[model samples]
Target: MPRLEEITPDNVSAAVDIKVGPEQEAFVAPVVTSLAEAYASRRTAWPRLVYDDDRAVAFVMGNFDPDNETEAFRCGIWRLNVDRAEQGKGYGRFAVLAFCEEARRRGHRRVTVLWEQGEGGPEAFYLRLGFRPTGEVLFGETVGELLL
Candidate 1:
């Protein structure tokens, strides 16, 4: 199973090097962009590098704000990307499970995610991971939630 490690000074460069294929560039931002957003939302975001054994294979950024009552979708995954070479190997699914576990550990009853609607989008993948549409649209993306 793949595990998540915080992007630290020692491994930030490797995490930044993680990428998806050209076709997926339109669906998800590069790791650098995700890192920048992490910084911008530092108060709630937890940016991580996904590792399988000793190799870095993916990048994930999530928000955990149990106190965010104003926004139902506040505590959720913000970004997720598995390097093209690592796709279809269950890494993304492992990462989602890990994120949900983390949210539950932090006392959250559920986790949520927002994704764009397109061919390469992760709507189906998230659904397979037990997430369901919340019927809430924000900024052109659909919101999905998974009760923990």
Candidate 2:
């Protein structure tokens, strides 16, 4: 199973090397962008690089309300991406599970995700993971929630 690791100064460069397929470019932001936001956003964004053992395979960014209030949004996934060569190998699902576990550990009762509409988008994938649409939209993406 893949695991999430903190992006330290030593490994941050390697984390930025990870990339998703061109077709998925619209679905996720690059690691560099996510990391930059994480840095600028302070405690609100928790960014990590996903690894299959020692091999880096993906990047995931989780956003949360630092005060445990909905200042911006609840605890939820902000970004997820697997390298083009590593897609369809279940690393994405592994990252989701890790994110959910982390959310639960933080006392969140549920986690929400916003995804853009399109064929081959993550709506169905999130649904399969037990996320139900909340009939809400964020930044033009549908909001889906999973009870923790």
Candidate 3:
């Protein structure tokens, strides 16, 4: 199994090179840049880069936020990606599971994942990991949630 590590400037370039397919390129390009910024920010967001041995293979970026005026923390899982050459080897699933576990460890009660509308891969993958669609779409992205 590949081990997950925190994203850093040293590995950010390699992580940004991971791609799913030609169709996903346009979708993931901007996301990669945004994730890099989040990683460099002061917020509590956790952006991770996964690796097998010393090679970068996947990534997951997310953060914990307080809901409304309550003390409850709602976790938001942002971007998740596994290299096309490394897909179907369980890397993506492992990354998501690890991210969720980390979110729980951070005291979040729920973790939400947002997927692009046309990305069947993400929808199916998240579903397989126990996330259910919330019937809510935000800015062309579908929202799914898994209670921790």
Clashes of each: 0, 0, 0
lDDT of 3 by residue, 1-148 (tens): 6888876678878877777677676545444775756857537567888899988888777766655342222577767777888888898888888888888887876888877756444677788889898887776777788987
Runs in model 3 lying further than 4 Å from the true structure? 26-31, 39-41, 67-73
Quote the lDDT for 39 in model 2.
90
**Best by the TM-score measure:** 1
- C-alpha TM-score for every candidate: 0.93, 0.92, 0.84
Per-candidate RMSD, Å: 1.3, 1.7, 2.8
The TM-score between candidate 2 and the true structure equals 0.92
- The models' CA-based lDDT, in order, is 0.86, 0.84, 0.74
Worst 10-residue stretch by lDDT in candidate 3? 65-74
On the 0 to 100 scale, the lDDT of residue 77 in model 3 is 73
Rate residue 92 of model 2 by lDDT.
Answer: 83
lDDT of 2: 0.84
Tell me the tens digit of each residue's lDDT in model 2 across 1-148: 6778999988898889998777778888888989889999977888888888889998888887856655227688999888888888988888888998998898888888889889767777788889898888778988888887
What are the per-residue Cα lDDT tens digits for candidate 1 across 101-130? 888888888788888899977889998888
Q: Which pairs in model 3 have colliding backbones? A: none
Q: What is the lDDT for 25 in model 1?
A: 89
